[model samples]
Target: MYEQFTKPILDYSIALVMFLLLSPVILLVSILLAISHRGNPFFLQERPGKDGKIFQIIKFKTMRDLTDVNGKQLSDYERLTLMGKIVRKTSLDEIPQLLNVLKGEMSLVGPRPLLPEYWTLYSEEQRRRHDVKPGITGWAQINGRNALSWEEKFRYDLEYVDKISPRMDAKIVLVTLEKVVKRHGVNANNYMTMEAFKGNVA
Candidate 1:
C-alpha cells in the first residue's frame, strides 16, 4: 500500500513543501554559482533513473570550466572553486534536485541516480538498483556516501530495493540530516569527489 500509493503522494507533497521553503537558499546559491561559473548556475546531465530510463538531473554548478593549455578540462579538484567547495560541503549544491523529485524523476529516498555511462557496467544484480526511482538521499548515502566502496554502495542500493517502506524511508531521512549536519563523507577516500566507477572485475 505504501510503496504503490502512499509513498508517491508523500514524496510529491514533501518535495513541494521543501522546495517552497528552500527557495531563498536556492536562489542565493544559484546567484553565487552564476558568478563563480561566469554563466549558467545549474548543471544538467543525463542520468539513469527508475527502470534504467534516462532523465536530466539538475544540480548547482559547483565547478568552473577550467581548461589546461592542451584544451583539456582540468580535474575536479582543480575546477572546484572556493565557493563550490563550500556549497558542496554544506550540501547546498543538491537543492536543485528537489525539482527532480517534484517532476517525478526522483524520490526523496531511494538509490541515487548515477551517470548514464555506467549503464553498461552494472552486473545483472547490481542493476536491480534501478527497479525503484532514484533519490536525493538513500540508504547508501546515510551509511557512508562517497566514502563507501562501489561494491558496498551497490549492496546497500539492492538492500533498499528489497525493503521499501515508510519506516525505512523515515530512518534514512533522519540519518541523512545527521550526516549533512556533521558534513560527513562528502568526499571519497583521497579524491575531491567520488572516483569514477570502473567496471567491477572478477
Candidate 2:
C-alpha cells in the first residue's frame, strides 16, 4: 500500500520541497564544483531500475577527470578532490538525485541501484532487489553501506524486498539520517567506496 501509493506521493512532495529549499545551496555548490571540476556540476550514470529497466541516476559531481601520464583515467582516490571529499562526506553530492525521485526513477527507500553491467552477475535472488524502485538510501545503505561486504549488502537488499513496510521504511530513513550526520561509513576503509563487484562469489 505505502510502496505503491503513499510513498510515491510523499516522495514527490519531499523532492519538490527539498529542491526548492535547497536551490540556493545547490546553486552555490554548482558554482564551486564548476570552477573546481571545470565541468557541469552534476554527474549522471545509467543504472538499472525496477525490473532491470535503465534510467539515468544523477548526483553532484565529486570527482575530477584526472588522467595519468599515459592519458589513462585515474582511480577514484586519485580523482577525488578535497572539496569533493567534503561534498561526499556531507552527502551534499546526493541532493541532485532528488530530481531522480521526482522523475519516478527512484524512491526515498529501496535498494540502491548498482551499475547496469552488474545485472549479469546477480543471482536470481539477488536480482529481486530491483523489484521496487531504486532509492536514494535503503536498508543496505542504513546497515553499513560501504562498510558491508557485497554479500551482506545484497542480503540486506533482499530482506528489504521481502519485508517492505512503512514502519521499516521509516526506520531506514531515521538510521540513514543518523549515519550521514555522523559521517559514518562514508567510505570503505582504505577505499573510496566499496570495491567494484567482480562476481567473485559465483
Candidate 3:
C-alpha cells in the first residue's frame, strides 16, 4: 500500500516542505559553488531510474575542472576544492535532489540511481535495484555507502527493492539522518569519492 500509493504522496509532500524550508541554504550553496567552480553550480547527469528510465540527476558541483599541463584530467582529490570537501562532508551537496523528487524522478526512500553506464553491466539480479524510483538516501547508502564493495552495495539495493516496507524506509531515513550528522563514510578511504563501479563482480 505504501509503495504504490501512500509513499509517493508522502514523499512529494516532504520534498515540497524541504524545498521551502531549505531554500535559503540551497541558494547560498549554489552561489558558493558557482563562484568556486566558475561555472554552473549544479551538475546534471543521466542516471537510470525505475524500469531503466533515464532521468537527469541534479547535484551541487563540488569539484573543479582542473587539468594538468598536458590537459590530462586531474583526480577527484586534486579537483575537489575546500568548499567541495565541506559540502560533501556535510552532504549539503545533495539538496538539489529535492527538485528531482518534486519532478517525480525520485522518491524520498529507494535505491539511489547509478551511472547509466552501469546499465549494461548489471546482472539480472542486480538490475532489480531499479524496480523503483531512485532516492537521495537508501538502504545501501545508510548501511555503508563508500565503505561497501560494489557487490555489497548492489545487494543492499536489490534487497531494498524486494522488501520495501514503510517501516524499512523509515529506518533507512533515520539512519541516513544520523550518518549525515556524524559525517560518516562520506568518502572512501583512499578516494575522494566512492570508486566507480567498473563491472559486475565476477
Candidate 4:
C-alpha cells in the first residue's frame, strides 16, 4: 500500500523540499566546479532505473578532461580536479541527483543505480536490484558502499528489495546522514573510486 502510493508522494514532496533548501549550497558548488573543470558544471549519464528502464542521472562534474601522450583519458585519480576532491569527499557531487528524484526517475531510497553497460552482466538474482527505483543512497551505501565486493553489495541490494518499508527507509536515511557527516566509507578500499564489477565469477 505504502510502496505504491505513499512512497512516491513522500519522495516527491521531500525531494522538492530538499532541492529548495539546498539550492544555495548547490549554486555555490556549481560555481566552484565550473571554475575548476572549466566547462559544464553538471554531469549526466544514462543509468538503469526501475525495471531496467534507462534514465539520465544528474551529478556534479568532478573530473577534468586530460589525456596522455597516447590520447587516452587519464585514470580517475589523475582526472580528479582540486574542487572535485572536495566535492567528492563531501558527497556534494550527488546533490544534483535530486533533479532525478523530482523527475520520478529515482527515489530518495533504494538500491543505487549502476552503469547501463553492466545490465547484461547482472545475474538473474543481481538484476533484482532494479525491481525498484534506484536511489541516491541505500543499505549497501551505509554498510560499506564501495568498500563491499560486488557479491556483498548485491546481497544488501536484494535484501532491501525484499524488506523495503517506510521504517527501513527511515533508518537508512538517518544512518546515511550520520555516515555522510562523518565522511565514512565514501571511497572503496584502496581505490580512487569503487572498482568496476567485471561480472560474477564462474
TM-score of 2: 0.96
Q: Mind sharing the TM-score for model 4?
A: 0.98
Stretches of candidate 3 exceeding 4 Å from the true structure: none
* Candidate 1 Cα outliers beyond 4 Å, as residue runs: none
Output the better candidate (3/4) by TM-score. Answer: 4
Per-residue lDDT for 1-202 in model 4, tens only?
8878999999999999999999999999999988887889999899999999999999999998889999998889899988999998999999999999999999999999999999999999999999999999999999899899999999999999999999999999999999889999978876778998899899
lDDT to native, each model: 0.93, 0.92, 0.91, 0.93
Model 1 residue 189 CA deviation in Å: 2.0
Q: Judged by lDDT against the true structure, how good is candidate 4?
A: 0.93
Model 3, span 37-89: residue lDDT tens: 88898888999998999999999999888899999999998999998989999
Residue 115's lDDT within candidate 4 is 96
lDDT of 2 by residue, 67-166 (tens): 9999998999999988799999999998899999999999988999899999998888889998999999999898899999999999999999999998
Q: How do the predictions measure up, each by TM-score? A: 0.97, 0.96, 0.96, 0.98
Q: Enumerate residue pairs that collide in model 4.
A: none
Residues 1-202 of candidate 1 have per-residue lDDT tens digits of 8877898899999999999999999988888888878899999999999999999999998898889999998999999989999999999888899999999999999998999999999999999999999999999999999999999999999999999889999999999999999999999977888888999899
Clashing pairs in 3: none
For model 3, what is the C-alpha lDDT against the true structure?
0.91
